[model samples]
Target: MKDVQKVLDWVVAEVGVPGIVAEVKDGGRSWFGTAGVADLETGAPRQQGECLHTGSSGKAFTAATILALEAEGRLSLDDTVEQWLPGALNVNGYDGNTITIRHLLSNTSGLFSTGLAPEVAQRYATRAGFRRHRFDAYTLQDMLKLAVSQPPVGAPGERFTYANGGFHLAGAIIEAVTGNSYADEVETRVIQPLGLADTYVRPAADISYPDPHPKAYSKMFFKDGTDLATLTAENWESLLEDPGLAPMDVTEVNSSGAWSAGNIISTTSDMIRLVDALAAGTLLPPAQHRHMWTTVSTEGGYWMPHARYGLGLFEFDKQATGGTPLRGVAGSLWGSWFFAIGTADGRHTMAVHTNTEWKSWDVLFKLIHAAFGLTIGA
Candidate 1:
C-alpha cells in the first residue's frame, strides 16, 4: 500500500498548510492518516480521527434530512417557502409562491446571500474584523433579515448563484414542518441511523468542537478582487503574510454565521460513511438521489471551471467519468475545508479536510488522484 501518511505530509508541506487528516474507506476496510501540526506553538501533530468543520460540505447532510422528510410525506420539494415561513418572501421582494423547496436546495432560487453581505463577509474575511467579532453571537433571524433586505443575485428559477441564505431558509422550513431543531432532525434522521458517533450539527452561536481537533486557521483578507481564479501570486503572498495580526485562529468563530447551512463539526470517518451512502443512494430513495444531481450550469468558471450547481451538490468538469458526478462534495468556510468522494461502483470512499484555509486546490486534486487512482481534474 502507498504510504498515504507520507503523501499527506508532502501535500501539507507543498501547500504551506498547517495540518490535514484524511480517511480512506472501501467496504469494511478503512485507513486513517494525518500530517503536519495541529497547533503551531505546541507542535501537536494532526490526528487522523479529529473533528474538522465540514462547511458547505454539510449541505449534503442538510439535503438528506429534507429528502428523508419528503420520503416520509411530511413535505414535498414543490412546497413553497411561504408555506413554512410566511413573511420570509418579503425579503428583497422575493415571491415565495414561485420559490419551491427544491429551488432552495438546487441553488436556483437566486436569493441574496448573507455571506456576501459586507458586514458578514468582513467579520471573517479581514484580520481586524476577525479579531473583533470572531466569537460574537448572531441569530438565524439575523441572517434571514440580511438576506431579505438586500437585492438578490438573480430572479427565482433563474441562473445559479451560490447563496447561503438558501440553505438557511431550507433549515427554517425543516424546523417549521417538523417542529424540531434542524440539528436534531439531522441527528435523528442521518447520524443516529448510521451510528456516526463523531458527526454533529453545531448549535447556533456555539463555536466549540469536541476533543481531538486541529486549531482552525484562516487567511485574513481585507478585500478580494472580482475574480478568485485571477488572484495573482502576489495576492496569495500578501494574504499569507502576517496581517496586523497573524493568521486568525478561527476555530471558535461564531457558528451561527453558517448555521444549518454549513455549521457541522465532523470527522473524515463519519463523512466517508455519509458520502458513500449519498453516492450509493442509501441516504435518499434511489429516485430522489438523481434529483440532487439535476445540475444547471453555474457559469462560474472563473471560480471553479465547468462548475455546475445541483440541489446542494456540485459538479465540476474535472471529476471522474467526465461528468458522472455522483462522486462527492467539497466545501470551505472561513478557515476549514473538507471533502468526500465515493467510487462509481460505491465500493470505495475517500474523505479529507484541512485545518488550514485555502491554498490547497492542487493538493486536493492530487489527494483524490492518489486515493482513487483516477485522474480527476481537481
Candidate 2:
C-alpha cells in the first residue's frame, strides 16, 4: 500500500498533475490512495474515493446497456442503424444501412468525432470560450447533427477510429428501441443490477460535479495542431507550468457534447465495480457476452498501441501491462482523465484518475506497473 502511495505522490510532486486518486482491488482486499490537492486554490486534499468526470469511460456502460438489451431480444448487434433511427446517419457519406451497433461499439463505424469540430472544440477546448458557454445545454439531436456535418472518416467497418459520435448515435438507438432516455436505460440495466451506487450520468445542463467531488481543470489545448501523444513526463512539468498553458478550473461546464459518450461521473470504487461486471460477464448471457469480447483491430498510431477494441472495452496488449493482458477503459474530457484496468478474471483491478486534462500515456504506463506489481499477489 505504501509503495502505491509513493507513486501517487510522485505523480503530483513530479508530474505536475494537480491531484490524483486511485483504487486497486486484489483478491479479497482493496486499497485506496490519493495525492495532491483536489481544489488547487484551497489546497484541499483529494478524497481517497471521490467522484470525477469520467469522460468516454461511459461508453462501456452505454455499450453494455445495448448488449443487455440485445440479450433480452429487444435488439441485435447486427441491427442496422437505419432500422432503429432512420435517416439519422444517411447524411454526409454515412449510410445507416451499412453501419451496425457493433461498428459503433467497436469504433469501426468510421464516423467523424464531433468533439474535433472547430465550433464544438471552441466551446470546451479554449479557455475564453469555455468561460463564455460552459453551461449551454446540447440535446442528443444537436450531437448527431454535429456528426453528419463533417465528412465520414472511412466506410463502416473499414478500420478503427475513436469516434464519440458513434456512441452518441448508439445512445440515440437505445432511446429509439426502448422509448427511454439512454441514462435511464443504462441505469436500469447496468447500474441498478450491479449496484454501482456511485456511478450516474450527468444531465446536459448539470455542470457541477456532485458533492464530495474533485474540482476539474484543463489547459485548453483546442488548436488544430495540438498533439500530446508523443509527450513524456519530462515535458509536462514545464508545459503545464507555462503561463499561456496554466490549467484553468472548468468544473462548471455542461457536458452535453460528450453525453452518452463521456458525461458519466463516478468514483474509483464504483468504476471498478462497473468494469468488473463487464469483464466478468455478469450483465449478459454467454452468447451475448462472447459478442462483447469479439474485437476489431485499431489502426497503428491511431489509438492505443496494440490494443484491440472490443464492444465498449479495450483489451490492451501485454506490452502495455508489463505481462498480463488488461481489459478496461481510459477516458479523458475537458478537465479530467480516468482509467480502469483489470485481468480477464476480474480478480485484480485498478481504477485511477487525475483532475487535470494534462495526460501522458507514458506516465500512466509507469503508474500501472507500480500499482499492480507490488499489490496484486502480496
Candidate 3:
C-alpha cells in the first residue's frame, strides 16, 4: 500500500499533474489514496469517492452490455452494421454490410477514429477551439459523418486501428435492437446489475461532473496532429515549462462526441469493481465471456504499448508489466486519464485517475507495476 502511495505522489511531484486518486483491492482488503490539489484555484485536495472521467474505459461497459444482449439472444456478435442501421455507412467508401459488431468492438472495423478528422481537430484539439467549443454538443451521427469523411484505414478486419467512431455504431445498434438509448441499456444491464452506484454516462448537454471531483486540465495544443507518441522527455519538460502554453481547465468539455466510447464518468472504487467483474467471468456467461477475451495484436506506439486489444478490453504483454500478465483498459481525452486492471481471477485490482491527460500512459505502467508488488522500473 505504501508503495502505491509513493507512485501516486510521484505522479504529482514529477509529472506535474494537478491531482491523482487511486484504489487497490487485494482479496477482501482495499486501499484508496490521493495526492496534490483537486482544484488548483481553491487548493482543494481530491477526495476518495470523487467522480472522474472514465474516457474509453467506458467502452468495456459498452461492450459488456452488448454481450449481455447477445447472451439473451437479442443480437449476435456477427450481425452486420447495415442490418441494424441501413445507410449509416454508405458514404465515403464505407460499406456497413461488411463490418460486424465484433469488428466494431475489436477495433478491426478499419474506420478512422473521429478524433483524427480535421474538423474535430479544429474544434477541440487547438487551444482556441477548445476554449470556444468545450461546451458544444454533438450527436452520434455528427461524429460518424466526420469519421467516414476521412479515408478508411483498411478493409474490415484488416488490422488493429483504434477507432472511436466504431463505438458510435455500437451505440446506434444497441438502440436499434433494444429500442432504448445505449446509456439506458448499459445502465440497466451492466451498471445497476453490478451495483455500481457511482458510474454513469454523461448526457450530451451536460458538461459537469458530480461534486467532490478534481478540476481536469489539458495543454490543448494538438491542432497540428502532434501525436503524444512522438513526444520525448525533453519535449514534455519544455512543453510543461513553456510560459505561453499554460494548462487549460478542461473539466467541462462536452463529451457527446465520444459517447459510448469515452463519456462514462466513475469513481476509482467503482472503476475497480467494474473491471473486477469484467475480468472475473462473473459479468458474462461462459460463451460470451470467451468472446470478450478473444484478442488481436495491437500496433505499438498507439493506445497502450505491448498490449493485445480484445472486445473493448486489452491485455498487456508480460514484457510491458515486468512479467506480470495484466488485462485492463486505459482511457484518455483532453482533461482526464484513467486506468483499471485486475488479475485474471479479478481478486486483485488497481484503478488510477489523474486530473490531466499528458504523459499518463508512462505513469500508468509504473503505477500498475508498483501496485502489483513489482519494482517501479521492473
Candidate 4:
C-alpha cells in the first residue's frame, strides 16, 4: 500500500498530475484513495466520488446499449447501417447502405476521422460563438449531421480506422431503432438499472462539479513551438465543438461532440460497477459479451499482443507496467486519465482516474506496475 501511495505522490509532485482517485477491488471488496489537488488554483485536494469524463471509454457503454437492444430483438448486429437510419450515411465513393452495425461497432465502417473533414471545421466555427453557454442543450442530431457529411476512407469492413464518426453513427442507430434519444436510452437501460446514481450521460444543469470533482488543465503548443498553460475552462467550448481536438471543457465535450463515443462521466466506484457488470453478464449476455471482446486484425495483419478492441472496451493482455497479465479499457481527454482492469472472470478489478492531462498515462503505467509489486522502470 505504501508503494502504491508513493507512485501516486510521484504523479502529483513530479509528473504534474493535478489529482487522482484510485480504487482496487478483489472479489468485489475494495480500497480507494486520492492525491493532489482537484482545483489547482484553489489548492482544493482531490477526493473520491467526483465524476471524470471517460472519453472513448463510453464506447463500451454504447456497445452495451446496442447489445441490450439486440437482446430485446429490436435490431440485429448483421443489420446494415442504412436499414435503420435510411439515407443518414453519405460517404463519397462508398455505398453506405451496405455497412453493417457490426462494421460500425468494430470500427470497420470506412468512415474517416471527423477531425480531418472540411465541413466539420465550418460547423464548429459556427458554434464557437456560444462558448459561454452550457453544453447539455446540444442535440444528438448535431453530431449525426456532422458524421453524414464526411467521405468514406475505404469500403465497408475493409480496415480498422478509429473514427469518432462510427460511434456517432451508432448513436444515431440507437435513436432510430428505439425512438428515444441516445442519452435517455443509455440512462434508462444502463445507468439507472445498474444503480449508478453518480454516473450520467450528461452534466448537471448548472455545469456544477459533482462531489469529489477534479479541475482540468492543458498545455497548448503553438505552431512556432511556443507553449502556454491555459485554464481548461476558457477553451472547453471550442474543444467540445471539435471532436478532433482535445477537450478542455469536460462537460461540453461529453455532452456535445464526444456523445456516444466518449461522453460518459463517472467515478472510480461507478466505473468498477460497470466493468464488473459487463464481465458478469449483467448488461450483456455471455455470448454478446464475448463478442464485445473480439479484436479486429489490423490492415497490416499484425495485432499487438497488449491491446485489442472489445465491443466498446479495450482488452489489454498486460498492464502497461508489465505486471499481472490483465484486460482493461483506458480513456483520456485533455485533463483526465481513466482506467479499469481485471481478469476475464471479474475476480479482481482496479480503476483509477486522474485530473491532470498529458501525464496520466505515464502515471497509470507506474501505478499498475506498483500494484503488482513490481519495481518502477525495472
Tens-place lDDT per residue, model 4, 262-361, is 7788888888888878766667787787777776654332222345566777655434335543556666654667888766677677888776444434
Name the runs in model 2 displaced over 4 angstroms.
222-244, 319-323, 374-378
The number of the candidate with the highest TM-score is 3
Error of 1 at 266 (Å): 1.0
Q: After superposition, how far is residue 155 of candidate 2 from its true place, in Å?
A: 1.2
Write the number of the candidate with greater lDDT, choosing between 1 and 3. Answer: 3
lDDT (Cα) of model 2: 0.80
Q: What is the C-alpha lDDT of each candidate?
A: 0.74, 0.80, 0.82, 0.67
Please tell me which model should have the higher TM-score, number 1 or number 2: 2
Per-prediction TM-score: 0.89, 0.91, 0.92, 0.80
Residue-pair clash count for candidate 2: 1
Candidate no. 1 TM-score = 0.89
- The number of clashing residue pairs in model 1 is 1
Q: What TM-score should be assigned to candidate 2?
A: 0.91
lDDT of 3 by residue, 93-156 (tens): 8898999999999999988766656677567656766788888888777866766787777899
lDDT of 3 at 282: 85
Residue lDDT tens for model 2, 257-302:
7887878888898888878878877778888888988887774416
lDDT of 1 by residue, 285-329 (tens): 876787776777766412344456667766654443365443677
